[model samples]
Target chain A: MPMLDLISSTGVAPNDVEPALFDAAVNQDIDALHLPNDADLSDYLDALPRVKSIFVDFPAFTDGRGFSLARLLRHRHGYEGLLVADGQLIPDQFAFALQCGFDAVRVKRSERERHTAEAWQAALDAFDVTYQRGYAVKAGPATSIFDARLTAAEANKTTDPFSA
Target chain B: MYRYDEFDAEFVNARVAQFRDQVERRLDGRLSEAEFRPLRLMNGLYLQLHAYMLRVAVPYGTLRSEQLRMLAHLADKYDKGYGHVTTRQNMQFNWPVLGDVPDMLADLASVEMHAIQTSGNCIRNVTCDPYAGAAADEIEDPRPLAELLRQWSMLHPEFSFLPRKFKIAVTGAPTHDRAMVRAHDIGIEVVRGPSGEVGYHIIVGGGLGRTPIIGETLRAFCPKDELLPYLDATMRVYNRFGRRDNKYKARIKILVRETGIEEFRFLVDEEFKALDASDIMVSQAERDRIAAYFAPPEYASDIKALDLEAQPEAFRKWVETNVHTHVQPGYAIVNISLKDPERAPGDITAEQMRAVADLADKHSFGEIRTTHQQNMVLAHVRQDELRAVWDGLVAAQLEDANINLIGDIICCPGMDFCALATARSIPVAQKIAERFNDHARQQAIGEMQIKISGCINACGHHHVGHIGILGLEKAGVEFYQVTLGGDATQTARVGDRTGKGLSEAELIDGIERIVDRYMDVREGNERFLDTYQRLGAETFKEALYADA
Candidate 1:
């Protein structure tokens, strides 16, 4: 099973998919993944699908994109799958990665695993909702009648609607 | 004042509820700080230097007596008993805790006021002429149009996440009291067409910042009916093409500069077609309804007599200094100078707000105005009731008659309050006002503007004064630089820096030298600006250093 069918400018885009940027997103099977170095992990939530996941290459330890994307995919994206933090999965980001949402994290079975998992669990117990856009579904649009009226928009006002 | 209809009430109530839930979620560790910053900013709540600061849009700076009283109440209960009137024509409370902001917003919502989009990188509170409807020489009252823009721009989905904040100001007054028709992201001024029909001469990219620009004329005559769609189209264009990557080069003004006004105009026109397809006819009609709500209040037909010669010496001085003529018969514009002796300019206590509100209800229309000069204005007052209102104002410590004169200054809350400021503006303004509080001497000196800023970010409007002082820090010691003859009017221009910066002590000495030079060379009764213009900066510059 792979959420890898989804390709986006911001996320772990399938290398096999041909793509322009900004206005384009495509669905394809994931063989190899390429996460843009400069892309902010914030917009990557839109790239995650409910089904499958992929192995993210962490080019460097200082480059924390792999960890940030891992957390978003797991905790924020609610994707339950393997996230291999290859390349330079430094000791520190591994803990933060696990705290964010990464469940099955890859850091070569090393002496640091026991120490890192404790820190990750400790971090995970601290909070929730680590995003600007709401991830959890609320029952309805959060608003009221009066706010709705003022924001009733340009098309709704009988008089100058913009006067609100 | 536009009263909150049922629709408005419901919206605010719902927003409050939603925010309450958001707070709960945060407390329960369901939300993180970064996730919640934009949400809070959208609601007009900012985590400032210390506590939260809530800025409410006083759209066009007009307030009903009741609304002013409500603000007073909010100040008394939640803040340090006063509000700071910002240069952008919004009021800010600097010391509210995060938890209290929701309730403060609720109180504002009761009066059809809310802090929405007052902060975020979105369309900001629309500003207009303080005298709007009452001012002479207006093609039309600009407040209605301002209100219309406030409604139209709020929470615009596409434009909400702009690269930076946007400001729009409007003025119907040919004199440009609103500072409209200047460099803003969008500046609008009402103009008379060939048939005497009212049209708008829209200007775009006018602003005050690191790279200030005088707005270029975007359209010569935008007919009244097409104004809304044109504005919509303009925003759409900006939303689409405006820079988002680099915050510094994000304001529409910068884009306009980079692309050139002619190309920007073409892009805007193309976007305007898209807006036409949306066809917001209902909203256009809604403008009429909102306009109706703001129609001039019916007044007394009998004109009350104002005896110009029956004034005492002090009364004459006050009258000559503070009062302005009104378009309505026997009515006058009463200025409640916020810059009282030794008081922080523009700071009004909660008690003072209530007092002004009461005065407005009795002597003027039940309305109060917060001028761009950091003072409150009683826009429509009967001539006969002037004495009574003045007495009340005097008791409240707001009766200083220094409007547009020395010491009636515009000063930013510099290093003392604003984290962004480099030096203290309050001290500079206070010292200057103290030096010239002698009423007879000030009257002799005649009309002059002495503005101060804590930093180059001229929040105190130091750039547009007859005598401008910008406070800076030189090796941790406060220093001030002077700029003369900068006007913030139809012909807005930033003053050139005069000489090198001087220490705080020498700053006043320098100001005195310049003033003395004006007295010696000025033609009789010519104002400071007139003298400075006629004599040139070189003359003023020579005087400043002559006695140094």
Candidate 2:
């Protein structure tokens, strides 16, 4: 597995701290926790204080439950610690994973070989603009098309005071 | 009718470039078919039974004359010779080489149109009442809202890959559900608040595939500005909790069904509460900007009402069947039927497309609308010019005068083109149309919807048809099952299945018998659905199975 930090746009060496499964993490003093897509965050609320890293399993790239889980952890339950997307994911999903609050993606060795690291980096700049706001990327909060339009409108207003 | 501004233009061009690159990658073996399928589908390309099918999104079913001309060009250049207007109010070119799709999309981009989100698990093209601005009883034009949602939902990173494809429909008229709102994943009805401020009544989880369910009311009144946040919240809930174990149980409807509407509402509200409304709230300025494009076109003040009394018998009948009342004085909405009994329903030739574009420019303020019933509408046609428009349509052979008659059918491209179809559907629809081909008989049967689907996917919306036909393969033989009393209006209901499947030979006769039985048992002035509602499905079942 190779870890790519989308926020930094750089590849990082895989960490030696293996994520403990839900059952083991519940019983043991594990700093890194691994949860399935269907893992209820409420059940893990007690363990959140001790866990420094959380790995959400995607199972398959098409199954998007992990994206929501990551968002729920960051925005809803306010889990600010490291969140890693683990399992089958393609380069096209790197930017979306980042937007959904995943700090890094741990890609399978096979997928990494198929889709080079350059491909993953290029995918980040695939679309310069997005239509959504509030979602975070490595840069900062996503700037929506509406936000850009509003800015342009404001700049025009300031430049031409007489124009309504 | 909303024209793309610089931002929209840039976004679509960028998307086209991305898709082109993806296609090149797939062709050169950098991307495998397993990985390329979802990507291509997101761009509205599908590998059908024949060649690739490219569905171009006609956002809110509104198109300009120039856009229609572009579609005509695409049909002539890329397809065999025609395009099919689907039940979702999108246009599908059934024959396009995989290599040529990128170029086809680039052509569409020139006309401010793209096929993005027309397919795939992402939110599909938002459909709306074709008669939005013209309908007499409309509360407000739903196109602005639809356009806003379209922009917000496109390329939405978080909700792009969901458990299954999501569909949304909007209806402005309180009296009619012309968009088939209640049969979609999220149905929106424009409503006036207590003080007459426009808002939306949101319905969640209504769909018509394997399991037919009318959406339950999720929100009584979602303020106009809060729509995106609310929808974002709903999508988040569905994406997170919707089942992924089985593809069949993956739609939001199943999630809503399993988790009770009450709990689902709680979850969505929780997600909505976490969202920052200002991040995505549609501003008043942006709202007005979109709405300005949809403002009613100027009309002739001195236009006189149409006097059909002295018109030819055929023209008068066409007006009686195809004309709909418009809000503007001396204006009418003209429905151009694509159902000719000779051609597949919704299939229109490129020549006819150009003719429609020309006619639209001359008679309908250069605007055309595609309907859920696979028909085209000239939304703002002056009553005085309708005769000329009718004449033009007749010249083009696009004038079928079967707006809601038995001849008007909504059918999917079944086994002839769709790879997913278990049996043929278009031939059955053609047979039914031919059997009742008489103008007087069709008019007498009156306001019947015969929707046919090749498989249980219900792309033809057979679940909501008045006389629904579902074609299936039983023991390697084609079998047709009929359902009765389905409605797609404000009071949406799934049709009840009648006993026994009929062979292709017996299907038309069974339908004819059902119609004959309805004629026998119906009260005066009642439509087929009204009669069915009064008499129940058992009566129709008896009629269908009597000879068997």
Candidate 3:
């Protein structure tokens, strides 16, 4: 086991890893590019269509720049290919990373054995509810409790509006 | 008295289960301490100097009698039989074993309460005017909107890991701003447009920390329905652009300051327009549904009036000092002071909690409210039952009768409890309270907010105090810096720091010197802050160091 692990919602392992350097990737026509945590996504927005995978680095798990970058890549640039979250990610934050539009996570080699595929699966299902919108969940984007309550309240309306 | 729905109940329980698992793993060596710290913090568990402190959220300061009883229960069962009320209208139990936290959370969940988002670098417990629904000057109750935000910001995916903790405060009354909205990250004042459409006047970037700054108005009149969308956009902008490199400059205020409010507003507006507003917005009907939960409890209009003549002098003083006017006639709001002598300010014992719960049930329609100044309020008490309520409070040692007075001080859990504190605040506050113990003198001093913070974090909100005392460590020795003329009202301003820091021994003497000068310079019953405003901080600064 190389411990070069990539976990996705579909449980499929990633293929043909590419170098992380931007100029090298551009010169070599690499399909995948792992950008540092501080990388500006707009600079590479045009190349997103051509690229198959974009792994945003999380230098520190607490530093959430990767969340913004992932969202920008997906929502702003419309990068539909696999978006990977790389480095220093805790298993608990997997859902947040995924919700921010990352399709996969490249677990560090040392911790790969402990963070198994089943563990990642369990981590995703840790919480059944989210209040945020624009998240990419397995069952498609989930509507918040407020929206659900509104729908229920609208359907159950039976009398004069202000009588109660 | 907004009861939790099935959704809220389930959400909290699920969070408890998740935290329980996280805690178990941490204990079993499966999860590292680093990984577990954030999880524990998000659940409102902090590793304090002595033991684990668990902070419980009292959403918008609204608590039912049952909830209060449950808090009392937790205090007796797990803690040291008392809980300290925080400035943000939450309660903190000083000692809880890490293993028992999950159980405590489960207990909290049973009461439709959990510590989720209470201590994390996320949207914390939304605070509002404690007298929100009952205030005579209130345009509308702000608690409903505050609750809506509480739901929206709970476990928000992107905002859960913010650069710094964010706070949001709402107020319905413009004249009597008890929430201190200007001192929060997001200050929402309920407003009505010229065409008679109700909405919010949003203020962004205002906060109190090492660098205290008042929030600037982002939108003068944001349509009521557009609030959620606008807030979503604003938070998104802050999460993406807020500085993370420096911990001290991580608040949205710094970003707003550095990038300029106008540019920050533009960025937020651009994001607001670009994001699909429909995806984030709740319908007016949904808003109405939430509002209906906070509707006024059934009232009995006919009630006996207070016998002003028959009351004792102490009772009369208590009525004048501790009671507030309510929107509904014959109803009065009674403030239960936690700043008693020889006790830590804002600490209520388990017995006192149960007593207050009993008082709520008997006099205030089984409801209680927590004020930002760390006092409890019986917001719907009948005026005729004032004497009875006073008697009950007196029996429980809760009738301090010094709210908004000199003795009723706001003191943070300083070096005594808080790990971040450089000097002790409780003793300084106690000494000040002792110095101004005379009822007549305190009444004469009039409405003055004396806030004390342990460190530059400003948890005691010393920036906006009428008289602020900041405790800082000077070469391993405790020292206090004084400030004057800070106001937390519509005309919000940070206090000006006086010259020189005083030693712990000189703190009380220095304050006395300042107060004596205030007494000497005062004319026509001017408050301390008013006198300071007229005479300026320079006079106080000179008087303070005159004897040094």
Candidate 4:
């Protein structure tokens, strides 16, 4: 298995730390935590300070609960530790995962062979811009298209004519 | 009517290129069918029972003449020679080959139209009142807000892959909800604050399927600037806590029902307070810019009303049913009925599409709107020029005086084309239309909505029909269930089940008996839904099951 660093847009070796389940990690003295998509974030708030890395399971790429979990962990709980997405996800989801506060994705060896590293890198550069804000993109924070348009209008100080 | 600026055009073109690459990947075996299904669905290409179905979004049900012509071109060149208007105010081509969908999307993009987010688990196309700007009772035009939401929700990163599909509808009129706002996941009503500033009243968790629930008000009023953040917070909450174990219970309605609206609002408020929405909010200038596109067209002040006495009796009847009063003084809003009894409801031929485009160009400032009732509206026609418009429609075989009559049915492409359907809905709709083919009788029935869906998914919106019909497969045989008193207006409610299901042989007769019973028990000038509300479902149930 390999880990794809979406922020750096490169494939790297996976970390050797074995993450324990939420119960085990909280009860024992483990520093790494593994959470399911449906795991309650409030339950782990106390244990998050000591946790070094949190691995959120994406049972399938289409299952998007992991993205929300990543957002909650990053924005709501202020978890500054390494958050890794572990399971089956396509190259198309790499950009979304990166924007949703994921640090890296643990890809299965077979899945990597099928999709290839270059495909993942290309998927990252597929869209140069986005429509929503409050996301951590490679270029600092994401600026919404609406804000960009308003900035352009301010710089020009003139209205653009409507053309259909 | 909002035009794409450079950014919008570039984004749509880029998406078309991405889809083109994905299609190539699928064709060359780089992607499996399972992996390719969601990607294709996000771009609005569905593999149906017969062939591929491509749903092209008509954003907020508004279109330019050139856009409509481009749709006709796609129908002629890539698909079967016609298209189907869906219940959500989008267009669906029934028989397009899988290989040609990318080219079709490219064509759509050329005319500022694309099918992005028309399907998949993303926020589907944002719909609004078809008469948004032209309605006489509109407090504000809803299209600008609908357009803003459309752009905001397009290819959204965090909310794209939700538990299930999401829908949003908006209405500008306080008294009438032609947009069917309460039947969506998030229903927004344009409202005025005490200081005369415009805000939105947000309703969340309304939906129809196997389980139908009318949405409850999530926020009494959301300030215009905070709308995006509020919606973002709502989506975040639903994406995080909405049920995923059961596919059937994955909608936001189920989450709202399970968590209750009060708790859901609390969670949303917590999320909303944390969101930094300065960059996401629409500026007043930007809103004004969008609103300018929907401004009323210049009307001819010298235009005079048509003389009804000189026109034929048929034309007078058509005027009575199809023409609605426009806010502009000398202009009228005309509905072009797609429900000719000989054809399936909402199906329009390529030639008819071109004719509509021509009519729009000549009479309605080149603007057209697709209604949620599966009809097209020429939003601005001069009173004197209506006869000319009617002549063109008659020539195109599109002049069916059945705007809100019983003949104007809303039906989904059921077993004939859809893979998920249990029985055929189009033929059933056509048979009912034929049974009541008499124009005078249909007019006498008066403003009746008979919605039919082939399965529990309720694509036909059977749950909101005045007379609802749901078709199910029982022991490999098709049976239909009738529901009564569903309303889709401001006072929206899900229809109640009458009793047991009826066979195909007994369905039409049963419906006729119900209508006959309503006629027998009705007071002066009351519609079918009004009569049903006054008498209740018990009366209709007795009429339906007495012989059995």
Candidate 5:
């Protein structure tokens, strides 16, 4: 009954005694907020400034509501904290989990028996090019193939005046 | 037709390697059936009743001659020598072994095709009007936009594990909705704004499985660059809020129905406003680059003559049924009838496929298009070479001469193949076609669509047929239900159910009786659906159960 977070390429354990401080969280005594997979984020949008970390649950891996939850927390609410994916997710979903803005993941001990952190990292490195825009790239600023094409087009325009 | 650039080519090749690795893991003990099921389905491999079925995406229903020949090669080598064209503008090989799928995929990748997302709970293969570029009524070809969406949704992270499968359809023509955009999850229509700005009219939450619902307009007009972001917002809303408690009620249509379209629109708008699309929007250069691949094929402009006077009556009938007007002069879009009475609708043999591929290279511009009605189209055939194409089709036994006629039925791979089917569909379609196979009699019936689904899942799109048939199992015996007056045109509607279910023999008789009823009380040149609408379903209901 442990959470498997694949967000960190080099896995991270759950912060012990962290999620149980809801009362303290209400009083601005804590910086983390743990939410169920279906937690309504509208009520917490006002509290995002106080909260530094959001741990979204994936009750089951088949329930993908958490992916959108993480996306909304990051892109919409502008939450730049440790967005942790905590649940039963496989290594195959590592790339997607990262693209959705999860900085760390907690995997179940059972799943870790066969799939190690290295396997998850390998899975993350499988795709060389993705058509999405929001992932934290291995190197420079986050950009899709379209952005790269735009940059190249601009470079060509500068070099070859007649290209336009 | 859109040609694959280096990016697309490399993307598909990488996917082939990935699928090969996944298959190897499955064959070993690394992945369980429960774990491997979704992965296999994402790659369009389904374990059906008989064997593994692989559905290959025909992106926007456009295929080059080499791609068709590759499909034929795969069918002959790895399948049972035939392929079935699906309603989603895909080709399904129903007999591929699990081990051979990766090799088959590699072969498809060589021809710039893949089975990715074709049968998964994700954004599926984007379908468009089969007559997109050639149709005279089109404002602009929707294939560029469709291609853009295809790339955007491929392996999309947050939206990949949707509650149910998502389908998007696009159409450029205002009047001729061959893509059935109104009945899709997200139907897009290309439109020109007041000042001549090209944009998209977006519709959301329409689907036709067990519950058939027409999509409501979400955005009247969104700028071209805003298409992907708008879609990202809508998908985020659906993924976050769609019901997962029940599998049947999990489609976006159900969500839109349960939570009103107004609320859904508000949620999407809020998300759209929040998401920063500064770097995500499709750049003009990228759009132009993609559009360039779809430039008009070189066509003979001076050839305006067609010698139909010397042709036989059968060939003339074929021209009348299968030929459609093109936007360009001296060119016609030819509809190849896959609904030959001798074979199942949409099922093409390997030899027939090769023949069609050769015909495509010779008559058309080495391109073929698959329609939602489970037929193939040569979208750029010249009028002068129409006779040669007709002759080639005749040699392959594909000259059915019944494009929109009674014999042209759309049927699903029912209990015979599909694991989800409750009763058989192909036999019933074959029987009905046999009863109404007369060429002259079929012409007399006029333009009618008889769509049959083995179960209420409605893969055959029976919900929108002029004469819809749904097969069910009652007391361990097969029974059929008849529905009337459905249309998938600009005016989309779900068919109304008639009397109780009938047996196989009685079902055929019932349809004949219904046709007889239409013949007796008919107006000139009125379609079967129009006739049924003029005289209500109640009249047909009475006529059907008069002797019951």
Candidate 6:
């Protein structure tokens, strides 16, 4: 398979693939156009009109900015595009990807495939659904002034005179 | 003690679960260490030089007896059977595995506790006085405001990530216990205005790093009600204008320095007007509710101190060394020194946690505090119970009786854990404390505080120590520099560096030389600081290097 490596922000995939290439065959892009490990959510928020599955870079796991980008693209912007993590993308991110809305992962051919696949499946198997707002996180009753005012508004039929 | 409501309970439980899931993925190799790192970090986990360290927040340095016991449980179960109290009033476990952390966090959550936001670039734990409610000199208890900030910043959408870490300290008393008005990213100190109304004196940009700055005064007087919004303004100005180009220069302290305090204040004031000040942010009812939670519990007005017909000389020494006056007339603030003579400074075992909790519940109110100097405090014990409390504490091997003395040293975990540290600090602190263990000799030496930092980040509160010792690596050899007559008291000042750094062998000898000089020159048994003030640094500096 010929890889379209993206080397920089201004660069694009080496091969001229049609938008149809996403489902037809697996194509890889390199560091061109400076896509992140987590695909650019803001860019993805715009129409991908041409590319479908693009490989993003993780750089490293500690670089959570990429992970966060993936989350925004999948959960908030609601991008259904196929996302494959490239570069320093570790299998650990695969589960977080699944949570963030990634389907498959890309790794070196020399990588342990079976274990990686098992871990990815385990991550998916772990959680059931998207949280309205992360059901798993502990909720604080009194969070914001707005939250308090809203709660107050709900409690008293009398209108809150001091609404923020 | 403020018990966690359902909301508090739920928040911590879910947070624990999230971190647990993240940890499992890391161990299973599903998540790369890079991807797994921030998740752990946001949850207060850090992979340092030796192993993973989890810094659990003892909010505003306040913890209930049961909450503290849980910390002890984690110490026994997952760590090296001990935890180190940090300068920020948090506890850091040196050895924790990536796998057992979720369970550790779960244990923490069961007691309405957490390790959340203890680190990372987000709002770190809010710090207040170790003696919050009962301190004699306080204008008001600072815990409620600390809690307010905790809620306002928790998982805050915009500030979950910022240019750099933010630190804020608060104090209610006339005497600064929290170092509140220092050069914090933001510092809050209570002051009485001409109207005799107690209002916050806001300070900004005071911090220690590559650039050490004392916070510049932003507001001489701000009403208590406007605090959150006022803080919102300060943060907004920082968020909009703070330097994002350099992480080191990103603290508010740098911004204030460059813009100048007057200009910075002008910018913050402008932002304050634009912030969400509508009833949504802080309403009367909301304030009342929060205030209700923090309302002082009524005490038995006539409660008398017990008759201590016998006061052990040891108890007297401990009292002389450790205890302080509380705001509550009959109560005393007991400082429990964690710096043992032979052991590492700030290392407290799980059993010790239970012991401290027992002391809190039995002798004092059910509250304990962790100080910025990495010591513990039993905040409101009746003076009458001092002997009994001392006896119980002594048995736990906790009554080091070295508070504020030369032996009560503040030392950081240097090369042992902090990858940033250039030299070992614990050994140096331990060595100094051991030298000063002779009570009479220590009295002769006089009131002195020794603070040590492995590196220059000043996490050990070294800058403000009366005898500040900064450990630096000189040609791969650990070298120590001593600073004379600094203080972290109500009126805090950074110490002046005396001269050249000393070698490890010569470090203790250097301290001894300085002390011996003070003893010789002293007109009385006043502190080293008083004598230094009376005689000046030239005499002490000359004495330190006289043998050299």
TM-score of each: 0.79, 0.95, 0.94, 0.95, 0.95, 0.79
Query: Each predicted complex: what DockQ?
Result: 0.05, 0.59, 0.48, 0.53, 0.59, 0.07
Docking class for model 5 is medium
Give candidates' CA RMSD values in order: 9.2, 2.9, 3.5, 3.4, 3.0, 8.0
Measured with C-alpha atoms, the lDDT of residue A7 in candidate 3 is: 51
Better of 3 and 6 by TM-score: 3
DockQ of 1: 0.05
Residue B480 lDDT, candidate 4, scale 0-100:
94
DockQ: which is higher, 2 or 3?
2
Winner by lDDT between candidate 6 and candidate 3: 3
Q: Which residue pairs in model 2 clash with each other?
A: none
Interface RMSD, per-candidate values to 1 decimal: 13.3, 1.4, 1.8, 1.6, 1.5, 8.2
lDDT by residue for model 2 over A1-164, one digit each (tens)? 23574323243323323333355545455556778888878878776767777878889888888988987788777888889998788878888888888888887666766788887777776776777766635442245677788888888767666675
**What CAPRI class is candidate 3?**
acceptable
Q: What is the lDDT of residue A159 in candidate 4?
A: 56
Q: How would you encode candidate 6's per-residue C-alpha lDDT over B1-548 as one tens digit per residue?
A: 66765555655676676677776666777556656666677789888898889999888898989889889888988988888898888999989887788888888888888887888777788888888887777888777777877766665533554557888888887565554458468788878888998678887888866676766779989987888778766765665567766878888788888999889988888767744454215556655666677666565566676554467688887888788987777778899989887878888988889999999999776889998877999888878788889889888998887777788788888887798999999888878877777888876676788888899887777777878888899778889888888767656677889889888778898898888888888886667778877888998898788767
Best prediction by lDDT: 2
Residue B290 deviation, candidate 5, in Å?
A: 1.1
Which of the two, 1 or 5, has more TM-score?
5
Cα distance off (Å), candidate 2, residue B165: 0.7
Of models 1 and 2, which has the larger lDDT? 2
Q: Write the per-residue lDDT of candidate 1 for residues B385-450, one digit (tens) a residue.
A: 888888898889888888888878888888878777888889888888888889887888888888
True contacts kept of each: 0.01, 0.57, 0.47, 0.56, 0.60, 0.03
**Which stretches in model 3 have alpha-carbon errors above 4 Å?**
A1-4, A7-30, A139-143, A154-164
As a whole number from 0 to 100, the lDDT of residue B513 in candidate 1 is 82
| lDDT for each residue of candidate 2 in B38-67, tens digit (9 for 90 to 100) | 999999999988689999999999999999
